[model samples]
Target chain A: MFKTVIRRAGKCAAVAAAGLMMMSAQAAEPIKIGSFLSVTGPASFLGDPELKTLEMYVEKINEEGGVLGRQLELIHYDDVGNASSARNFASRLIRSDQVDIIVGGSTTGATMAAVPLIEQAEVPFISLAGAVVITNPVKKWVFKTPQTDRMAAERILTDMKDRGITKFGLISGTGGFGSSGRTQTLEVAEAMGMEVVADVTYSGSDTDMTAQLTNIRNTSGVEAVLNFGFGQGPAIVTRNYAQLGMELPFYQSHGVASDSFLELAGSSAEGLRLPASPLLVPDSLPNDDPQKEVVQNYKAEYEARWDSKVSTFGAYAYDGLMLAVRAMEEAGSTDPEAVRNALENIQGYVGVTGVFNMSPEDHNGLDPDSFRILEVQNGEWKLID
Target chain B: MLAEFLQYLFTGITIGATYALIALGFTLIYNASHVINFAQGEFLMIGGMATVSLTAMGVPMILAVVLAVILAGILGVALQRFAIAPAKQADVVTLIIITIGASIFIRGIAQVVWGKEYHVMQNFSTDQPIEVFGAVLNSQSLWVLGIGAILVVGLVLFFTKTLIGKAILATSMNKEAARLVGIRTQMVLMLAFMVSALLGSVAGIVVAPITFTSYDIGIILGLKGFVAAAIGGLGSGVGAVVGGLSLGIVEAMAAGYISSDYKDAVAFSMILLVLFFMPRGLFGAKVVERV
Candidate 1:
């Protein structure tokens, strides 16, 4: 009689323990994050690395039991570097997926195209583009990780002023990125007391920029050539400059920060200078700098994982994702409004790019100091002292 | 200012040479088929892309150029036999759409073949620029000008001197009448596509040293060539030459003097002005409608 009673009690206890485990598993739902980028088109150079970086981090975070003890789920779409496609995907992410937060848009044009819809949806958006207009007026729900075009211009001008380059010739592209860069550069140039001797523009598709170069060469008192464009434009200008045998100091924007620029420009890229994130040359950074550790860690991990060099574009996405995660953790909720509040209050969070101090007034949270002026010496980037 | 003017003039002329060659190709194909082969630009792209790939594989430059031209010719013949001939029963608008579809299809194939990044070849001779009258011109530009001149002269002679050319011309004028006269209209049409493709590839090979080639390069070049052909008179070879060179010079002047931002607008605006005045184009034969 005693043995039968003990066996029945043991069976009841085991069944109750199994029932309690099932209930806990049902209560913990995964956190969903949505993203759209130029993953397979012309701008894939930017978006491909960014996507890889996000995947790498999400995997690592999940391996550590995720944030708030929930797994992270990523939903992404390839925008194909077109505005209409970006807008369509952005709408779908908001209406259909109903993700808690959104991140990405590799190019300036793609990012701007998705901004209006994202604003209406009231979801926290952290863009990976470099355009200043993304957060100039400050959307409550929007934040960007990359340094703005205005900030890049400011950095370039500061370096130029330090080098005593007073007269400048600006050759810009007719595309949206080039035009925006032109405006910001001109604004910064005027403020720095620099003289604009020649202003020329070229179509992005033009095979020959010699006509524009010739005009600039003939302009008097031009001490340096500042090219504000991307892709083959900068390379074409570099080739033409060398062909013309002009020895003027050459300055390019951060758009041509990748090693592909080096391969395209060949030997002509030797002396060109541009402002870029320290992630590009982590070894040259001082040991005491706060960003040095983060940049090194990211570069080592990414190159090991993908067998490819990390780009500032990828670093931007990394910073944005980490920032969003931190904000969510601090808010202790995945609610969009709560995340937005936490993000704006974020301060001195050291990311791979720099220390980010976000606020209601500033959505980007990065200043001109975040960029380091770098020069190409013997086909590799060297930190400019 | 004088040197700048010369510089712009030289650049314009060099760009105009490529445009002229493309316009000539447009003329030949349009004459034979009465269908605009929008895929003409893809022939140029294939030529450049093929040459680049072959040369990268250690093939001699001369052999690469010849092989690329032949390959382009074969693609042209295939395009006619497959894409165009099958759509013979379609209306004019449908034919145009078919050609557009063919162009896009060729571009897609090229993207898969060569990848999306732009590729460039070294100059045919030396990279040294020759100075003339305060203006500098690269040696490759000379090659472009030389070949462009030779092709123009060669085509004119072929059309006037060769019996085969006359049969092709006869077929173009009236396909039914030419068929009654024992001329094979289908053969003539195929020959037209082959010749046009050959010319486009030559232009591509010669100009690749100056302008880098990518899959998307075909779209703009095709539009420009079509515009040049329209301005030159749709069916006139000499008019294509004149129209292309003039368009180039005018565009360069506008970019140098007015504004580079409005350069494309200036070129297209000139075309609009000409079309507004001459409904049949400068060199096009006047056609009267019978109601």
Candidate 2:
């Protein structure tokens, strides 16, 4: 009888323990990840795919048992490409939503607008914009994915130097990306002891760039030409360059590195080289390259899921989201300070854009070599090491 | 040196032809109702975008062009009947403001339907550029200039020879007087809009290969065309052609000779100088108020 009573007591203890464990699991709250992106307005092309990638990956993680044994709840707002609105949304995310982390900022204006707030809140932010200013000075809690325009300039100039072309003509658009790239190119050129023999600019809306290009063509000792512009402007410049039949080598910035640019430029794009992400030539990457599989898989998955072409801009978001998840995993908790510290110390994380190795001193740990120099060969992108 | 000058000139003339076509559309509407149609640029955008999408859908290029133009014509009639005719008693300024609203609304709808990517249209002729005196000219430029000349000649003949054309001219002169004489002023107004839409779309299609096309392509082009029309004295066909050509050539010259930075500034300054001397524009009608 005493033996039976002891066994019954053990069974009761087991039932009570199971009930307590269930109660504790129910008490645990979900981890919140906040985002503010330009999902509409002028920057929709950058934000649309970013939002898609985040949503898809968040769902995938949840399905595979979310980070830290808790589901991730994404709180997002559309800034519509406005800086003021982005600030408002960032404030709301920190104060009202009480999110643990942020992994978005589709434009430099939006990103910079939210920096002070995120820093004060001690929250980790991984921006997707491609300007050197975001991470160059190195905020404690901030990191970025895309290689900056400065890095693109460095890569192009290095390649030019390798080819024994020291003097080049520079033509840029007056838009934000183009103008910033022009400044960075000028600075990089000066540092490298190169000569900018001719410099000119065209407005965003100007359809004909032949006049400006003609001026470039006439410049004495202009051994090469670099067009640091984005959108259809570079394509027009490419066509005009061919129309003039100038034999000088041509280089375009990363802004116009896409398949759409290829279509817009057509045969005129042949033999023109540009600094770009390996995403543009995923299949051409050799088997031994680390970025080869990451980029190819990203391109394939993004194309399959979105039913559209994968852009370099979208790759920025992929890297940002992945980096955030990685930092969270390393932290082992949703604590803001821990996540921020983890993000700063992240090393050798393979991503669609590049292999990231973040440090406190280098918030954006990408070298100029991350931008692959690609050439248009027979209407296809050919990888050049 | 000569080659550089020729190159800039070719670029100027090609772009000028497009502006002149768009300005001519503005002239037709301004003459008919004394209201400048701000939706004129939307007509151009519709032409280029529709043709591009149609061709992408496997339609033949020539047929796509025709269908796109027809669609724009219908839209023009809808704008007159639905948007304008209901506010018949509104003043000319109010009507012009309505055109502005109509353009924004049209652009919004286009943005939804097409999204926001620029599209390429193949040249109507060979991709090869013709070289003259070491300056290259795109083969598509010929098609633009050729079609522009034909339309200009056709517009002249229609305004002079046809009875319906005379009716339109009469309505433009005095709407009440034409209505009293059984000219059907509303019908004339609708016809004017349709013809102008057709003209604008043709210009858009021909220039698509040169400038590329997008949902928002009309904004800048429309503004430039309006400048051309204003400089040409608003209602004179000859003036529009001259204004557009001069504006384009001056812009090219400024970019080539002075600086590309000052290209637009120079163009705007030219307008200021012209208006300072001749307030009614180079060919504005002399005052002969009926009163």
Candidate 3:
């Protein structure tokens, strides 16, 4: 009888110890950060560096004692630049991974593809895409880091207005980014009450845009020309523009704002203006600029870590992650609702892309002025006032 | 107004000349074997990319061009000997599919080696635009035109004047009869592939200045070349040239006068219309069915 009593007490003690362990496990559960990016395929240019930045910073954050004393577990999926696959991966991240927060979508199409599901799930999602449509309606759960195409159009038009040029010719590519940029530019132009003398478009695969540029040049009242295109198309247009010898001021969208574009277009890119991230002119930025230090440090760290030149596409990821961390910290927990609220209320958060001042109505809190207009001079980027 | 017309004409002709070069390559191979080489574009890509990378590695431009062309030629020979030759008993459609597979494999390898970024080659002669009657022409366009003409003339002479060229022509005419007459059909086929590859690479190199060189640069250009070849009557040299120039001119005129948005649509529609009327292309051989 005494032995049986001792066995019962021992069983009770074991249950208590197991219960204590469960409590500790619950207290220290990892904060799962889910992501779906176009890590391969055509959009790999955007997702490659983004994945690298995320991986590098996730490790760095863990070493620095992860957010809110819980380790960050990154559950990532490569969507291969397909929107349907992106949607599938995002669904997997939310349903199977059961993540605390999500941070990805390397393209506007991928981001917009997954937005409705994210909204329904009510999870905090910080997107790295640049389409204005992503955050325009301001879904409660979704926020974006990259400046929208609308802002690019606004900045370009504002700069043109400053130069006293109201009439211009517009040529754009028929691709997704190009078409969106074209629409936004037209809307912005209409809003500003400026006249677009000639508007033409070419396919992405077009080898010669000379005929299209000639149509623009022949338009009578055109004082300047604006090109909204991506990839080799814009570079080809730049070359064609120079060949046509139209002395009108040439402006490009942010799509071709990279060193490679300059190399492709060569001397033809000279005097062409575009809106670009300050990261392109890191050292050229004034010391007093708010983003100067942040831009330089991110560029240095990314280049050192990856051994590749930093791209503005990757910078979107950096800002997205930092914003996510900031939101979680501000909320003091990884609770989805608290984080979403915090992310929405984020104000004056200086990031590499721009100083973000997010509010409930403005999930992408970047101002149009955040984009600095840059001019290509002597085969290099020169910041324009 | 005439200047505008000239501008469109120059643009059309320059691009047309490139398409003609590509079409000639397609015509050469189709003449030898009924199989259409889908990997023809890959040879062009190889030529342009090799030259760009070689020049980047500090090799002299002339030497780089020579080496790049030679490399493409070797690739062409290897493709014939290894990929196409292995499936000797395969039907023409199967052989065409094999070429498609081979092209994908080549593209994948190139993407890994060169990375996915466009590279520019300096113009052969000058960067300045040649102004005539207020219409500007790219100096590189002149090189493209001149080189295209030279290649076409050389091909014509090679077929008519040379013994090996005559052997290739004989093989194209009748494989069994050519073999009965002591011509080695396999060797002729390899020669055809090599010569076609050479033509493709030369076209690639000249146009690299106008359209920046990249690993996948050949896909659209190659397809367009094939279209030009088809329009000209797949196996006829003169047809390829006429078809290419007309295709280019129509595209330029459509993009200029009509709608740039429907330029490709218009071009494709033109092809549909042509094939609907002339089932055999413009310059197609008048072959009587044996059966």
Candidate 4:
């Protein structure tokens, strides 16, 4: 009877230990990160690579024991490049799924649509779009990784000014990103004492822009042509410019910083210059530059894993995710406010775009120095001094 | 200023020629079946995408183009036979909806087959532009103009001189009467679809070098071509060409003079005005039933 009593006590102790373990397991739940991107629509060219990059890095991080011993749980959705879809998905991520952080949006318009929702939810949201307005107002909960259109415009103007190009012809598309770039360029040009000799616009679906090109060509004071668009519009403009046999130098925005542009433009892409992230021409970057290693490693790994070329859009996501992880580490907790504070104070973080130095006033943490002026030579990007 | 006007004029004509080709396709199919094939633009997409794929597979440019046109024609016949003829008893509005459904289906298939990226074809000749009075013209534009003209003339002659073409006309006029006269109305309908598809593919193959082609390119091209046909009178071949060319010129001049942003608005507003005034279009038939 005494032995039976001892056995009963031992069984009770084992049950108690198991219950404690279960409670601990509940406490160690994974860090939930939500991501919504334009994975299947017009902006898939941007979102597909970004989604892939995020998935790839998350897996790698999990394999390395995750962040602070808690595995990351990613809830991903396709935004379809629509603003309404992005906003709705973002709300669902915050209110329904209860993600700790959000990372996504492939285009300027879609990203802008989600900004208000993220701000209202007071979640740490890191965007991958390249619009300056995303960070200019400096929301407490918002941050972005991609270099802004304003930076691209400033880079173009600086390069043109260095070349003594005072008069310019600006041809832009009617898309959100294009028009925004146009406004910024005009704003930057005025401040830089530059004159726009001719201004024209074309729809994204326009088959030809030679009418615009011809007008620019006929403008006497126009020393260079600047085309701003993200899709095939810039490539079409390049082709039209070549077909018209214009002698002036042509500059494109950071939007066409992909090899697809060269393929679309064909030989007409030759001699075209654009301000682009160093990720586009990593090999051309000097070894002393900090972005060289980050850019090269990401490109090599991404190409090896996906069997496709890496784009600047993907690099933006990569940087954003890395920054988010860094912030999480610095805060030592997944609390949204702590993470936001950590992100704003992040300094000298070397990324694929540039060395980011974030502060309270700056969320993008990138400037004109982050962009390298690149020229297309023999169907490849060549860095210019 | 003279040079600018001339340049815009030439560019407009070049673009209009391609639109004319598309409009001509719409007219041919409408003439036979009185059903608007909204899938007309997919013919262009298929032609360009197929040529790009075939050329990548080491096919000669000329063979690739010919094969693309033939393939489009066969698909056209299949579409009519399986999709259209199966629902012959449906009303005209239903038939038009069926065509729209077919267009969306074809576009979806194309997106799957070719992916969503834009594809380009090499120009038939050099890319150098010919200078005339300080205005420049690309050689490919000349090719587009020439092919469009030849096809228009060929179609005119076929409709007038060929026995089969006359049979198609008879079937279009009165299907029961044509059947009683021993004409295979079904066969003529199939022939009309094949011919229209061939015309659309030809236009796509030639104009792709200039405009580039993507899966969704057909929607806008089809809309504009429909506008061209409607403005020219749906069943009139000559009217399609004239309406398309003139519309193109007017759009170009507007872009050159007023505002590029309003170019499409101007073209569409003109269509609305034309529809509001002359319900039958500029060259529509004047036949009225003696009620």
Candidate 5:
């Protein structure tokens, strides 16, 4: 009987120890979040910064004891800036990785392609791309961190009106982004009582803009030139303006505000005005502004890590990840519906991009107020009022 | 209106000069090997990046340009030996696909090597705009046009007057016949690639300041250069220059007058029209094929 009792106690103690080990392992597992972006190809410039921003925020959150006492984990994949790859990445992240939430689509084409899959999976998605239709139809699972092209146009038109600019020359690329911006700008220009005197369109890769600029210059009563493009168009337009000796003020799309614009445009990009998010205005923003902190931190970390400058695309990704983390915490669960509701209810959350008050009706959560008109003066960007 | 038209013409000539340089490069290689090197643009990219990076590293401008050209020439030789020589007997379409594949592969490697940052080499001349005929033009544009003309004349004289150049011509005319006549055909092929790369780099170094270069710039420039070569009649050196200049002027006029949005469309359309009308190109001699 003594031997039997001793054997029974030993078996019980072993079982108890095994249970404790299993419990500890379970507790150590982190709450994983899925991320996808274009880390290569044409849009890599935008996606690389976004990836860096995501990494920085995830590190910060994890260092702060994570969200709701669970360590935050991010699983990132490079979509190579293609739509088909983005869709595959979305399905894999949702169905296989089973992440708590999915965030990021680097371009409008890629983001739009991934939406159906994200919706079907009933997962929350926040796109970093700036197409308005991504949110206009109001897909329940879709949200975006960047301001839409329409809002950018509204801001540009508002700035033009404030400056008493009436007659304009519009040059746009044949690509989707350019077309969308051109259409919106024209509509808003008409609404704002401005006349578009010349409408010139060019392909994305065309290096010479003198011919188009000449046509615009020939058009009667054109006071300003508004160029909508992503890559070489803005630089070409700026160069042509200088070449033609046109005295009209040149306005550029936000895409031209990257660090490479001045390098590509040489001296001609000086004094060029464009709409840009607050992320680029770190030196001008107030010290205590939340945006300033995020920008400063990102600049320091990114420069230290990659020896490169941060862009607006990076700012969006950083904000998206932070917002997602906050939502997860507020909901106190990893449930997709709860996180979505929390994101919709998010109020007074200041991000590197802008202040967010996301709601069911409005997914972008920011508008024209988020961007400031900036002028490139002596190879540096200066805020205009 | 005349001043504007003149200005467009001047701009067109400058760009045309650059295209001519690229076409000349294509012509040299195509004449020797009967193979189109699709990676010709990658050579331009490499040349631009090499100069920019070397200059940034504190090398003198002349030395940087020379080193860039030499390096690109070496790369051209390597590409031909490794990628092209193996498939010399392949069909025309197969050769074209191989060259294109080589182009993409080179571009991918360049991106990894240089990163995807736009790079610019400082202009050999001052960047101040010069007023010529009531229109402003960069001093670099004048340099590019002048250099392009000099290189074309130099190439023509070399091919016509030099013994080695004669041997190269002999090889290009008939590879089997040249070999039977004691000419080392393989060495001529390597020499062709080297000369082609040198021409491409020269163009790249001259135009880098005006256009700026990224890894992605190669594809468009290469395609346009190839188009210029085809339109000019592939094997004719003088024709390449004329063809490139005309194409550039036509494109500028089309963008200026008709529609900027369809400038590429106009260029490609002209190519199609030329191919349909003049199958042997503008200067190519018609050859009878025997089955």
Candidate 6:
């Protein structure tokens, strides 16, 4: 009876050892990607679309046989658009979850707050927000998909100049994104030999922009208006501009090219010039381009799923996830260092926005050349040559 | 130059009129409960959104506006009864924090319910521009300004001449004494909240056509309304109207002359400066407190 009991115990021990080995193999297996987004809050307009894009890319990659023969898993947390919340989530993603890579933050404030934590963890971090300062005080592991304020300002100024706008009225919000964009645009305007005739400012929440518009209208030699704000600022400006009967050419920051802008601005948004990626103007791009194909598919899928068209915020996040997948494949492993090296050395990778050529120095991977000038024609964005 | 300046003044005054309406709402609640209803802006949001949604659902414009106001008034009463009455005897700071929490919760629920989209009510008149002194203004602005004036005058008459209105005034003056005199002071407080919400919703409905409405519009609107109320004197109705209009004009003028981006900063700075000099507010009556 003792010998029989010992044999049964030996069998049980062998099975337990095999189970431990299988669990260990499964634990260190999948490529885990982390996302911190503002799925609720003022910036949810951007974050919700971004989260959708991330999910879409993950599904697409998994269907294409996964990255490096291992499935990619996304672990997400809602930052609620606050800097402190973003920092906490970033730490958890790095320390507790032990994600292989982190991708996509909603805003510059949140992204900037998480940057130091990410650098300490030595993990790759890609941002979808457009603040120029994020890349300027460059961290080694940080890469971004959205064009910086500098690139956007340069593009806007060049386009405005082409449209015979010399003297301009500038209006911006006092927030970080607004102030940064305003400064960059002013610098670009001066560089392009354009004069800033009037400069006006408003807080992020001001409903009436009439006083500012009136001042701009009164400014001597003001031939055009350049608005540097996002969210409701542009809507207020557009409405006031129409009310003031100002017929000067109006240019908005790239931030104004969303469905919410049209809804808020109404008919006042007609004929406004803004520089945006081809993602929003998919119908205008050539059929042969790889980006065109992907954008077409994405639009169809997104519209079918959400009953809405994709925005620029959505496109950036979509491209960000695709870029991460490519890097993972090239690195041939989920190792953070290997992925960082692969991403930094990325060359001629065609994306929904443009062909990206990432280098050691430039993390954005795209420039003003990636943007196309678009005008709101009949309440829809139409490409301008 | 004179015409342009007059145009700016008219524009400023019109916007000031809207702010005054919002301030009246704040004053009503503050006078009755001695608690600032931070969710007052949410009343405006609800008013605007309710009207827009109703109009979209084939309700007549007048009916939609009336429904929106009534709905906001109900919400106000519910909020007071549930959130405020429970913490009525709590410290002033605690009451303030509770109201703020309620505001955030309402804002969150608004996003979930309304889906983060901006909505606009149709203008009372056609959206065509009306020329006034070399400046073009929408016909809706005139309606907003007119409605604000009428509401202020109506409120003035109600508080002075009506029995219920005078009861409310008596309650605001001395809650315990009024209760001792057979007045239901709690009912007066509920009435004040309802009236305040009704006023805020009316303002929102009028302005929705001009500015459009969104889920997040409440926070800034609430802050500005509070500032307007503070600038005037928290308990004075006439002061709220005057203060709100003044704040609007000042913000407009600052945007016109200095920089538009700093207009909000200028408005807040003016309020801070006012509070620094006149702790009792611009028109607040001096009161003696006995311990």
Counted clashes in each candidate structure:
0, 0, 0, 0, 0, 4
Per-residue lDDT tens digits for candidate 3, residues A226-304, read 9998889999999999999878999999888788898899999889899999999999999899999999999999999
lDDT: which is higher, 3 or 6? 3
Question: What tens digits encode model 4's per-residue C-alpha lDDT throughout A136-200?
Answer: 98988888998999999999999999999999999999988899999999999999999988989
Residue-by-residue lDDT tens digits, candidate 5, A259-344? 77887787777777898987677889877767777677767777787677778788888878888988988998989999999998
Ranking by DockQ: 3, 2, 4, 6, 5, 1
Model 5 misses residue A42 by how many Å? 1.6
In model 1, what is the error at residue A189, expressed in angstroms?
1.2
Query: Which runs in model 3 stand beyond 4 Å of their true positions?
Result: A1-28
lDDT of all predictions: 0.88, 0.91, 0.93, 0.90, 0.85, 0.85
lDDT of 6 by residue, B195-219 (tens): 9999989988988887788887777
C-alpha lDDT (0 to 100) for residue B82 of candidate 3: 95
The list of candidate 4 runs beyond 4 A from truth reads A1-28
Pairs of residues clashing in candidate 6? A201-B260, A201-B261, A202-B260, A202-B261
Candidate 5 lDDT by residue in tens digits, B8-79: 787788888989899988898889988888888888888888898898899998999899999999999998
Give the Å error, residue A252, model 4: 0.6
Candidate 6 deviant stretches above 4 angstroms: A1-28, A288-290, B87-96, B272-278, B289-291
Q: Point out the higher-scoring one by lDDT: 1 or 6.
A: 1
Interface RMSD values for all candidates: 1.4, 0.8, 0.6, 1.0, 1.9, 1.8
Error of 6 at B11 (Å): 3.2
Q: In CAPRI terms, where does candidate 3 land?
A: high
lDDT of 1: 0.88
Inter-residue clash pairs, candidate 5: none
Runs with alpha carbons beyond 4 Å of true place in candidate 2: A1-28, B288-291
